[model samples]
Target chain A: MTKPRQWIERTIEVGLFLSALLSVLVTLGIVGVLLFETVGFFKTVPLLDFLTDTEWTPLFSEKHYGILPLFSGTFLTTSIAMAVALPVGLISAIYLSEYASRRVRTILKPILEILAAIPTVVYGYFALIFVTPLLQKVIPGLSGFNALSPGIVMGIMIVPIVSSLSEDAMHAVPAGLKEGGYALGSTRLQVATQVVLPAAFSGVVSSFILGISRAVGETMIVAIAAGLQPRLTLNPLVPIETVTAYIVQVSMGDTPTGTIEYQTIFAAGMSLFLLTFVLNIVSYLLRKRFREVYD
Target chain B: MTPDKTKALSADPTHAMEKDIAFKVEDLNVYYGEKQALKKIKVDIPTHSVTAIIGPSGCGKSTFLRCLNRMNELLPNFRIEGEIIFDGQNIYDKNVDVIDVRQRIGMVFQKPNPFPKSIYENVAYGLRIQGIKKRDLLDNIVEMSLKKAAIWDEVKDRLAHPALALSGGQQQRLCIARALAVEPEVLLLDEPTSAIDPIATGRIEELLRELVKSYTIVMVTHNMQQAARVSGSTAYFLLGELIEFDETSKIFTNPGDRRTEDYITGRFG
Candidate 1:
């Protein structure tokens, strides 16, 4: 009877360990799949042409396999998105953490988080129908489908990401710091700007980097609203194609399996993966290096 | 005779001796939302003297100190009904700027809360806020304030190092230097040495003794011995009520209330 009961307990422990192992396996499998296909893609297409060539036209008869134009478009849209998101998100975070009353914080925090919960596809539709037309009205030169509308819409989508994380960072700052400033005769604005903001800076920077990563990897909004033209232009008013948009475009087309056209999608996927990976590494390093944990 | 009787006898001489009042509180009552934190408190703080408020935790001693400079007004739920006059001006008056009041009546907190900036910046912050742009004046003021706080020798060489990097005692003194840089008429220290080690605490006590020669200082301390050593005048409090106010020597040696006696003797808080 004792041996049977011991066996039962050991079996349960083994089951828990196996489940934890399986979870790790699942993560490694996804990464392995992305890497395997990406490697297969580089084999078919010369690495230099895929990296350095200016044009990305897999659909045309004379297809040029460069990833630069897609990268530039992705870079441009993400820059615009960050430009819109960083200041508004950071200011709102400062207001919530430093100035807002309990009632205002309780009500406004949930409302800001609700923006993050809205689906990306819905943002795509809004960008396509509402934001695009709105931009056209203000700027006569804006194309019917341009990167500006989607980038701005993506900025709105990413705002909560920046605001929430930055708020958490600002909230972690000791209340004593602000009290110290007040004791020194600093006004509310001065304390918020000089003391609180500087203390929470590394966290704010990490949050902004994470927001940029989210903007770079966002697919549906750029696909629907930002037209699928891999033209390398800095102007947000023009139609452009990001790396994520190129993947969606390739996946939707009727290209035969194992063909160069199909393989080109993986190449773009690898670029997207690399960009976000670097950003995540930077976010981690900034948090670890600069964050001050008060006892 | 009881300590209370002796205190009553000794109090008259100090009251008769002093002619100037640094701050006067009249029937001050403070409330946080529905909770009354400070009962009717009326006391006169004498000029160029060290006044210590001694009480158990949460007994409105700190709250009363904050009231002198309207620092309690920063809390959202904090409301008060009373008059606090500093240097012949009603601090709670509608026309009076709280910022200006704070500038004239600087504060040092319980924990050493130096800003994340450099030590030089922390000491220079108060002067900078007043829009003093002359580099020479700022350099002179920083050196003088640090010297006054008794931390100049320790931190003078590392002025550009981050203020947060200082030892706990050094940081607290740095905070004091920051307050002094503003050249306030009064200095309110809310448990300024509570977070430091005993040796560091001794240094702060020594500094406080020196400071009262120039600044009217009101300190709230949990350490009974500390109150005895540093203050010229002492106010005993219990459960939001001011139990007794008298000279520091009399309060420790001869208190006028049973509660004050019990508190000082380590019988009950």
Candidate 2:
């Protein structure tokens, strides 16, 4: 009986080990696939040209592979999204954590989480149909499919992410710290801004980086609302195509699977992946350095 | 009973001698939702002295101490009644700005909770909150406060180092220095030495004698020896009631209440 039990335990251990190995395999496979296509694309378009290109018109009859246009679009939309998300999200978080009663927090937190659960495609339509038209009434030069609308909509979508994560960080600040601030005769505003905010800042920074990462990678909203013109301009009034939108545009069309146009996306994919990976690392590092060290 | 009559009746013998009272509690009742944490707590805490509140765990000692500066109002379900007269004004009055009340009454917790900043920044926090931007003024106050707390000698060289890098005892002292920098009229220390080692406890107890000259100190301590050694007047509590309050000497030598005697002698809690 003991021998059979020991055999079964060994079998379970090996099974558990394999399951753990599966996660590492998934990450390896993604890197492997990206590198395979990226290498092919770089071979046709010189690495320097791809890096330094100011225009991204590869699909045109006269092929030009300037990747800057795509990058600028990605940055522009991400910046707009961040501008919308950061203050709104952080203030909402502060309200929830510092000012809101427990009863209000209980009622409102899930509703905010529900905003996160809304499908990104629905957000895309909301941007295109509702937000763009609304903004056109105010800004005369606004394009039919400008970066501003999608960026703002995407910002709204990411608000819950920023607010919720930041709220967790602020909540993790020890009650003793808050009480200490109060004891010092610091007003509610003083305590919140000076003591509580600074104590939870590393966490807030992590949330911002993660929010930016989420914005950089978001696809459906930009594809639908932000127009398919990868123009290398900072003007929000002009139509723009984010890196994700360009990828979606090519993959949806008749660009042959193994062609240079098709493989350009893998390089773009690499850029997006590298961007988010760096952000996640920074967030992780900041949280570790500050959170564990303080009381 | 009338307020003056009640105050006269509850006045312990030391009250006649100690002319400057820091706080006077009268029928101070505090409730956490429906459950009563303190009931009819009435005592006179003297100014420029250390008044140690001693009680068993969950006996309303900390709650009573918190009520002096209206710190208990931060809790959602916390309901407070009766007056805590600080100096001449009622601290619980609606017109009183809680911010000013807190500025005058500083508290250090059982755990040392220093900001995740440099030791210099930690001591300078209270001053910064008050919008004192002059670097010279800040430096003078920080130096004076740190010197007063007696941690200046140990931390003088490494003032820019993160406060978290300090030893546990050092952190508590840093917290004390931070509280003292605000120049509060009264300092509330809730078991400030409980989390520190004996050597650190000795340093804090030694500092208290000097501190009480400028600031009125209200302390809640579980250690009976600590109460006897550091405090001028000691108030003993049992299940949310003020059982005995008198000169620390009398409480230890000849407790007026039987329960106080039994607890002091380690008969039972």
Candidate 3:
């Protein structure tokens, strides 16, 4: 009877272990497929030309396969997105965690989270129709389908991501630290700015980095709102194409499976994956290094 | 020996020291939301004396201590009624500034909560908040405060090290030094040594006894023996009420209330 019970427990433990193993295997399989396709694409298009060429016109008969223009466009949009998102999101987090009462926090936190839950495609249309037209009134150079509109909308979409994570980190700071500051005769603002913000700095940075990763990988908003012209331009007021947007553009159109044009999407996908993967790892490390585990 | 003798002793002018009262609480009642925590407490904390409030867990000792400095005001649902007079003025008055009161009356917590900063920065935080920018002045005050807390010699060499890197006792001493740097007239400690080891506790108790010479000290502790050893006066609280307050020796040896006796003698909490 004891042997049977031990056997039953062992079986259950093995079943749970197998489930965990399966998840890891599935992730590796996806990455393996991406790597295989990316390698095959790189063979057809010389690695240097794929990385260094400034123009990407895969649809035309004379296809020039340079990924630099796409990269520059992606960088421009993401930078604008971060510039808009970081400060607003962080301040909102600070306001929620430090200033708001419990009832207010309960009301506002869910509202902010709902912003994140909105479908990306809805934000896409809003940027294309409402934001672009509004910007066209103020700036003479603003295009009908510009990166600025989509970047601004993407920033709004990612605000909740940064605010929620940052709020959690700020809340995790021990109450004793704040009390210590108060007892030292520091004002509420002083305590929040000097002591609490500094203590939670790494967590805040991690949140910002995570937000940047989300902005970089974001697809639907940039695809619908920003024009699909991978021009190498720094001006956010002009139309630009991001890596995700390029992939979406290529995949939506008709292209044969064996064509080089089709493989370029895989190359862009690989670059996007690598960028976000590096960011995720760095954010994870920052959290580990700076987290204060108060006993 | 008795009340008559004490009165006679008080009559001597040269030996009769007249000290100002640091805190006077009259009919002070505290409530946390719907639950009453402190019930009509009336007491006077003499200036520059080590007074310890001793009781079991949840007996309102810490609550009463927090009320003295208005630290309880931090909680949104915490309510207090009645008067708390500090420095000859009612701290609860409408015109009184709560921030100024807190600045003058510093507090140390149960667990060591040194900011995640350098040792020098931790000691200099209070002064810095007051906008004191003179490097020489901050340096002198840091050294003096650390010396007063009996931690100067150990930490002087590692002034730039993180405060969190210190040992438990050293950290508590650092917190005491941090409080002292602001030159507060009174210091309220809530179980300051409870989270520390025995050696650190002993060091902190010794430091408290030394601190009573210049600053008024009010401490809440669950350890009765510690209260007796470190305090000049003792107050016993139980079930949200003050049971007895008197000389430390008398309270420990012959408490006026049976609840105080039961608690001190380990009969029941």
Best by lDDT, which number?
A: 2
What tens-digit string does per-residue lDDT give for candidate 3 at A1-295?
6999999999999999999999999999988988888889888888888878888987788888888888888888788788888988988988998999999999999999998999999999999999999999999889988889999899998899889988988888999999999999888889888888888988898989988999989999999999988898898888889999999998998978867888888888988999999999998898888866677
Q: What is the full ranking by TM-score, best candidate first?
A: 2, 1, 3
Question: Which residue ranges in model 1 land beyond 4 Å of their true spot?
Answer: A1-9, B1-19
C-alpha lDDT of candidate 1 relative to the true structure: 0.90
Model 2 misplaced stretches (Cα beyond 4 Å)? B1-18
Clashes by residue pair, model 2 = A185-B102, A185-B103
Backbone clashes, each candidate: 0, 2, 0
Per residue, candidate 3 scores C-alpha lDDT tens digits across B49-100 of 8999998899899899988878888998999898998976898888998888
Fnat across every predicted model, in order: 0.80, 0.91, 0.82
Best by DockQ: 2
Candidate 3 displacement at residue A120 in angstroms: 0.6
* Per-residue lDDT of candidate 1, residues B170-198 (tens digit): 99999999999999989999998899999
